[model samples]
Target chain A: MQFIEDANKQALEIMQTAQPTLVGMGIAKDVVPGMHKKLVMHAGPPITWDKMSGPLRGAVIGGLIYEGLAQTPEEAETLAASGEIEFDPCHHHNAVGPMAGVVTASMPVFIIENKTQGNFAYCTQNEGLGQVLRFGAYGPEVVEHLKWMEKTLYPILKEALEIHGPIDLKNLIAQSVQMGDEVHNRNKATTSLFIREMASSIVKTNSSREDQVKVFDFLNSNDHFALNLSMPAAKATMDPVGKVKHSTVVYTMCGNGTEFGVRVAALGDRWFTAPAEIIDGLYFPGYSMDDANPDIGDSCITETMGIGGFSMATAPAIVQF
Target chain B: MQFIEDANKQALEIMQTAQPTLVGMGIAKDVVPGMHKKLVMHAGPPITWDKMSGPLRGAVIGGLIYEGLAQTPEEAETLAASGEIEFDPCHHHNAVGPMAGVVTASMPVFIIENKTQGNFAYCTQNEGLGQVLRFGAYGPEVVEHLKWMEKTLYPILKEALEIHGPIDLKNLIAQSVQMGDEVHNRNKATTSLFIREMASSIVKTNSSREDQVKVFDFLNSNDHFALNLSMPAAKATMDPVGKVKHSTVVYTMCGNGTEFGVRVAALGDRWFTAPAEIIDGLYFPGYSMDDANPDIGDSCITETMGIGGFSMATAPAIVQF
Candidate 1:
């Protein structure tokens, strides 16, 4: 008991003192350890192709098309079932993603480093709401947008970050929290703050004005843009706790569409999993409980770090939504 | 008395309904009526060169050098004293500027239009704090910076405004008031909000990335950048009240470094003046009351519109400064 208490205290200290800085960005294959061309990472615990849910399957198919591995949904499905493509959890590769979080090798990711622990975490950019790859819409428009993000958004932000140096995530988050952002469901303030902070450097990059404008417009319109950064920041913060031997603190909590899973500090890579439950929350127009997918995404990492739903009172505006 | 009360009601209604929109920008000589190559507009009521305060005189010299009419301070002083040059108040040409408020022929000025009144008001861009033209430091660096603003900053913002259409100042000010900005001495929130609003369009301009970045960097670093806009908006808002018959409202208040002046509605263009009072507020480091300049600039236009210091309670954070 004494050993467990001490380990928990150590884990708590690590979490409390973690300094997550958004260091830079890179293509997944180039930066994420063990990422490969044929490898695909999804949110939550690992699942075989046959067990994957609709949204997850849709995202994977979209990712394949976006990656140029397959031209059509039918072809993507066949290749996925052929076992030639390897599927793994984003968590296994020091990454986290949101709903149907399918990340392929070519996707751009934010590289967040936790200075206190000298560890890093990664996450892909958020493709704002409605008919997006995250929600499993693999349309041509979605693929084109993703291409634009890779071609235009990625390099501009990368260069801007170079100019801006590493931005302290802890400080940004603290400021946003005070400004009425839960940093998960309500990131409007966080996104605005980020835009304000990056506008100067972003304009300085070599990107053409047309491209720069596109980036600014995209970020301005997407209130959820900072969610990706916040997720990786949480992931980086919690990763050190995983190494605290004898600590029983829950370090990761995420759900694939088919199942919910969590990992404890002392459990050492073992996941405690159960059947995922359907969300009993508000739905968009023309949708109801019957159309709802089961609980999903590594977004719960925000709640795991005591924000998001854990601190809903900080963002009263989210209640209306 | 009844006629005056009715006129006052009309003036109040006009002020309440005034919609000042930032329409565009142009050179003062080209857009401001009565502006000429040899005419220099200063703040407050008109004064001869001999009576001008030290800061006002310094700004006049800097304006001459900036306009290329003189090569040195001595040449500038000779030109000012030679009767060949003209000195007038910015208020005479529907303009307002801060501090010494010197407007030269080629200086860029924001064109703020009161849509309801179909009249326009103009103000030069704020040069930010210390050792600048507004505070009357006319070093080579100041002249060079002023040139950069005319050549680089003006076109980018002008094109961006063309793309952005008209920005409604009333709505922007309302939003900023809620965010702890007095829109005068504290324009941090207003500037940030303006940057967030304009960034998308600014990036879309035809300017080179280097130039665009310079513009963004300039705006981002200058927390008082929006002060210029607010002053012109206030001027535009109060200008309509000046046309009301028999109204006793005090609509215009400004100061040259040498004297403070006020204009009353229904009294036409008559200016009542007194020797300017020295500011008894906080001083910057290495300065004291003994070194203080008299109360100066067109900044008090914000106070005239019932914000600025008039509504200081709305911006409690300004007290710390």
Candidate 2:
């Protein structure tokens, strides 16, 4: 049998939903474009001093202060240098953070389990961006947004999902594709469809409009917002098959809140390092490429599977980066 | 060596969007339960004498009158007997009619293509049920509604689809499944999503609220309103495979608007007739199996490839017919 068939694949074991792998204790890192507050979580790969980028370095310093590991950016630099604080990429530990990839402990992550496969992964919600942790921008606003996502959006989504049971990603992908989504670059149909499906449940379960709006805004915020959903889905998909022994399918491409790397299933989690590719996407009328940072998380596999860029033909209007 | 694995056997060819099938015009025969005055077009599965329900028979007479084949119902009956007028089932010809699948040569239809599969089928716009032809209800109201759909709904959809291009059935199926649709039954998500996608295009192309509202009302009226879309998509998928020799996949199933029949690739185009099985679906509450027509039309095969009944698991709320 082929290691994996593009037409379809079976989830061998259903991963049950569980507690967030890095909830309730992560240090806030800062922010980045299309993402918010960064926090330092464990990593699947390690990095030496030379590989860090300005955005990633900025995130590390910011995460230290958020976690109270250091009182100032200077102090945080010392802390990381002293190696007293732990530094790990989000992917190694079954999690992925958005740009800047800073996932701190105590940050309540939405832990996703592939139901047909016992593999699991975690991700934080997307924050409406510009000067956020994932964008390598750190300050009061980033932390506050992170606080809101953790305190508000996560709870509402988690509760609604529990009541609704598993949100079948495969099923959603199929329906979304038919409705005009290729499932990677364009998710307007998928996102709107998902919100309408669960909106009733959210309204019924959450008494406050403010609370309900919090979740809604998060989902409706960014266009790449569905990227979060697609990432964990790919991670969960790769995790199970990674153990198949010599299977060439890719498992994880991640960051240590510092540098980028890729992991292959056949290589037994052996990492292949490469500088993250520069993002090519539409910018604000005044903003251009110099403002864009290199790729920062493990969401790349979404492209490998005939989606994202592969399915760009389905979305002719996707803004060119 | 599996029939399904061979691209020439089971793979559906892509469809082009410009030319829609089921193009001929037709007069309505009333088959509605609680309404009247609706006209429609149908595709595929030819129907013949002795197979029609009484309401349908009455509709045919009315159609002859509408077409001016006879001056009255009594005269129309003579026309049918003399074979002076046509009485072909819509499905027998790559088309479908609303309800009793009524059609006459004059109504306009939406031409959607399976661009990726190069196969096509057609259906008329929905006539709102209160006075529509599909329910076996016939009269001026049915005729007026048919006019409205043709004049209003069809144009807006045509323009919107033109701007957006072909609607991909595979993607739609995936999204629908995730959105909690078995596609056939629970399509709340799919229907809503499609509306939102087309809303912008409608706004841009259709300046008349009257026309816009007509399509809107029909879509919001029934959950299965998107069923027409699914039919053409299934048709396109089946066409390529149907032409593949030695392929065992069944290509067509129809009731000729009266008797149920199936056509398989390996078995050739010769239709094997079967007594139409009773259909199982929600009928405007209070209506029981006594109210349902036997499973008719080429529409049911949409379920065979994992939609409709095959996807019952996705929509648990569907009632047993």
Candidate 3:
């Protein structure tokens, strides 16, 4: 019991002191450990193509097309069923993703580093709300947007980050918390603060005026733009905690559309999983529980460190939404 | 009393419905009515060169150097003593300014339009905190910074405004209130929101990356940047309210470094004046009440509109500062 208590204290201390800084960005295949052209990383526990939920399958189809491995949904489905493409949890690759959380070879990802522990974590840029690839909608528009992000947004942000050096996410998250942001569902203040911090560096980049304006407009329009950063910040922070031996602390919590899973600090690589639940909360017009995907995404990692829903009182405005 | 009540109701209605929009920017002599090359504007009620406070005199000297009217502070002082500059209150020309509140020919000013009333108000860009022209410190660095604003900040903002059209200050203020900004001393939220709104247009402007980054860095560094805009917005909003016949609402309240003044709606342009009182509040390090300047600036226009100190509850964070 004493050993467990000491281990738990070590885990807590690691979580508290971890300084996650946004260092840079790169393509998933190049940056993420164990990532390769044929492997696709997703949210939560592993699943075969046959057992994947509708949203998960849709995202896989979209990812395949985005990667140029398949031409259409039918083609993507056949390729997925051919056993050539490897499916793995984002956790295995020191990464996390929101919603369907699919990461293909060519998609750009934010690289967050825990300066204290010398560890890195990765997450893709958020595509914003509604009809996005994350939410299982994969039309031509979605693929085009992804390509634009790869070609336009990626280079601009990468250049800006070089000018800015490393941005301290811990300080940003702390400031957002004081400004009534839980750093989860209500990220208006967080996004605005990020825009303020990045605006200077972004302007200094060699990108064209049109491309620069497009980046600013894209960031300004998406209140959830920082969600991707916060996820990896959380990932980078929590990953070190799992290295504490005999710790009973729970670090990783996420759901694929089909299964919910959590990893305990002491358990190393093993996972405890259950059936994913349907979310029962407010929905957009013409949508209800029946239209909902099973609870999904690596976003619950925010709560593992005791923010998000655990500290919802900090963001009273979220209730109105 | 009943007639006064009805007139006050009219004034309040006009104030409530006023939509102040930031339309553009221009040199004082070109845009502001009655602004001439020899004429200069100070805050609050009318005053002569001899009666101006130290800070006011400092700003005037800086303005002279910036306008190329005088080469040094000694020459500026001699010119002022010789009565070459015609000094008047900013209110006389439908304008407002903070701190020392000095405006001179060739100084760039923001054009705020009351879309509801079709009237305009103007104010110069904020020079940021400490040893700047607004506080009346006219060092060479101050002069150079002012020149940079004139040559660099002005042109980019002018071009950006053309592309952005009119930005709605009322809506922005309403949102900032919810985000904990009184839009006076605590304009952190207001300034952040403004940056987010303008970043797109700023990036789209033809200015070089160096100039664009300078603009963003200046704005990002100044938390009180929107104070300049808010004062003009309040001025534009209240100017229309004064046009209501028989209205008894106390609309205009401001202070020159030497005197405090107020104007009621029914009283037309007449001002009731008293000797200015020194401000009694927190001060920066190495300064105290002993070093306090007499109450100054047209910033009370915000308080007249029931914001600033009047709506302090909305911004609890101000108390910390």
On TM-score, the candidate that comes out on top is: 3
Task: Assess chain B of each prediction and give its TM-score.
Answer: 0.97, 0.77, 0.97
Local accuracy by lDDT, each model: 0.88, 0.56, 0.89
Q: Give one digit per residue, the lDDT tens place, for model 3 in A1-321.
A: 899999999999999999999999999999999999888899988888998998888999999999999999899999999999999999899999998999998999999999999999999998876678888877888999999999999998998899888999999888777666787787777788889889988877877778888999988888888889888999999999888999999999999999999999999889899999999988889999998889988998889878888767757476222
- Compute the lDDT of residue B269 as modeled in candidate 1: 90
lDDT string, candidate 2, B1-321, tens digits: 665456333433322222223222222222211112322233235554455665566667655555555676677666666644555545444555444666665444545454544455555554544655655555666655666665666667777666555555557656666544676545555566565555444545544544544455566565665666666556655655566676666777656445676777766667777677677756777898887766644456566344776776545364221
The best-first sequence of candidates by TM-score reads: 3, 1, 2
| TM-score against truth, every candidate | 0.83, 0.50, 0.94
Error of 2 at B13 (Å): 35
Task: Give per-model CA RMSD.
Answer: 4.2, 13.0, 2.5
Interface RMSD of each: 2.4, 10.0, 1.4
Highest lDDT: which candidate? 3
Over the stretch A227-279, how does candidate 1's per-residue lDDT look in tens digits?
99899999999998998999999999998899999999999899999998999
For residue A270, model 2's alpha carbon misses the true position, in angstroms, by 1.8
Q: Write down the worst ten-residue block by lDDT for model 1 chain A.
A: A312-321
Ranking by lDDT: 3, 1, 2
Query: What is candidate 3's lDDT per residue for B1-321, written digit by digit as tens?
Result: 888889999899889999999999999999999998877788989988889899899998988888888999999989887888889999999999898888998889999999998999999998887669988888999999998999999999999989888899999888777677888888877888889988999877888888888899988888899999999999999998777778988889998899999998998989999999988887878998899889998999999998999877757466222
Which residue segments of model 3 deviate by more than 4 Å? A1-5, A314-321, B245-248, B314-321
Instruction: Choose 1 or 2, whichever is better by TM-score.
Output: 1
